[model samples]
Target: RAIAGIMVTIPEYFAGKNVLITGATGFMGKVLLEKLLRSCPDVKAVYVLVRQKSGHAPSARIADMVNCKLFDRLREEHPNFPDKIVPMSSDLTQPELDVSREDQQTLVDCINIVFHCAATIRFNEPLKDAMQLNVLATQKIMALAHRMKHLEVFIHVSTAYANCDRSVIEEVVYPPPVDYKKLIDALEWMDDKLVNLITPKLIGDRPNTYTYTKALAEYLVQQECGSLNVAIIRPSIVGASWKEPFPGWIDNFNGPSGIFIAAGKGILRTMRASNDAVADLVPVDVVINATLAAAWYSGSQRYTRPKSLLVYNCTTGGINPFHWGEVGMNVSLV
Candidate 1:
């Protein structure tokens, strides 16, 4: 979007900036990683923190991710695109995130932006596990961000359902039901059985531990962000791409695609759901775009604004024009 030959500020801001991303292997994480590399071509480098998965090392996982069909468009544009990604070994569940001393020092010295995208997305995740990944890991990341000397902005990819207990969702970070400090302490001493036994009562009105812990994580971010330029992007029901890299681009069978696929194939018959409910499904690319733009703005010109927490609810709100045909076809048949 060059007006008189000047590059657009959003892409321009990302130029020459080193980025550190957590959860670079998840569904939305893959899209975010790809989009950052493709869109911000001149960006210095992308450091992705990855834990070993399914007997694959962090480096191997990163290679598999870049080689996936999702990066076909990106690979065509830049044949050596994979060279820009540097996978750092780190596990979110471990103490201090398992980030080694040298790597931690390197990140502190060179990282310009931090995107904490990792989280346990399971709807039925145990309270202890969810709090560990979503809340405790976030707390550790915030501490790490505080140490980054060149950090310009920190963007946390949160779910729109973080505040699902509310009837009307707002962009503001709502007050969490429990104090994260107390919860963390309790989880340390409390047995898994006890936590599971109290899960229903702990989550209260929320459907699962996912949302409850996410809400706690958001609150922790809000409290810990301090003077850092930070933005929390809460995307709802992120589905396939609308039209960035490609249309109908989805990697996983989780989320709405699973239900839609089953119904489309006449496998899922008469699933219980209200037609009147708002299915707030957002595209993965859209969320990535918003996240990029938000970082640019948060880092560039928004410094003068009263450090008010910036939260973006990136969702269709059940009223988008792009969704009717797709939903009508997939869901109506069921």
Candidate 2:
């Protein structure tokens, strides 16, 4: 049933499977890629959908990603690990993900699994940009997934804060604040100034544009479940690695990583929080593992399971709960 506590058949599920991954260069995405390469060694190929960033090509970026310290163990164990990671130049914000005709055809013909992780995570991002990257891009990816000749599973990565307005979170898609289609159509012709004026009201009780659009994106993704195998993984405040490639492996200052860094630097003097409020800090590796598990389940259990989108609320609050008072104390000690 399990090998070293991991499901024995999970690795077998990915064997010789062609995986198409978006956001391959992001925090969680990189860890997901590494685990797949290191654990699922027999995987046919990992097609990373990337774009030209900071004047560097996708291939160059991927080469640098594989050389990072996170993949040190993997590189040492399997020197040819990079061979399976194939980078395909594409932009999520563009039509058809800005993938070339040749690459598009290749994806449609061979890609068996899809991981849509690319999105604008900035909390202060403009509504239009967030909608474009989060909502519209998701729609485009779903359309593309439908065309995949051998597609078995489509895993979408969303944030746990997507429905933060609600106190009790569950593994389900909640109603959006507004109709996604109507909002998209209304914002089509609105100028930047007018949209900005109404942005706060549009987002309503939600904290930021990021969560708002992400919720809408989830709704849109669910609409495509009838046509393809779909699963959504909502991770809460993803922190550094737990025990996969290495311990304390973190690259970005996005969530708790930033707070930890600031505390270490002695820059974070004081913080305010309800002492008893639950701090849901799920590690990046745990999220990736859950993602892979979801993929395997979607593929192998489709026939036995009901015909509906699977939503995995990958959080640790209910199981191993930690409070902010304890977190602050730990950080202070550190």
Model 2 agreement with the true structure over 231-304: per-residue lDDT tens digits:
99999888998888878889988767887778778898677888899889998999999999999988877666
In candidate 2, list every pair of residues with a backbone clash: none
Error of 2 at 235 (Å): 0.6
Error of 1 at 196 (Å): 1.4
Candidate 2 Cα errors over 4 Å, as ranges? 1-8
Cα lDDT for residue 178, model 1? 85
Clashing pairs in model 1, backbone N/Cα/C closer than 3 A: none
lDDT of 1 by residue, 50-111 (tens): 98888998999999888888899999998888888999899988887898999999999999
Model 2 C-alpha lDDT versus the unseen true structure:
0.90
Position 305, candidate 2: lDDT: 59
TM-score of each: 0.94, 0.95
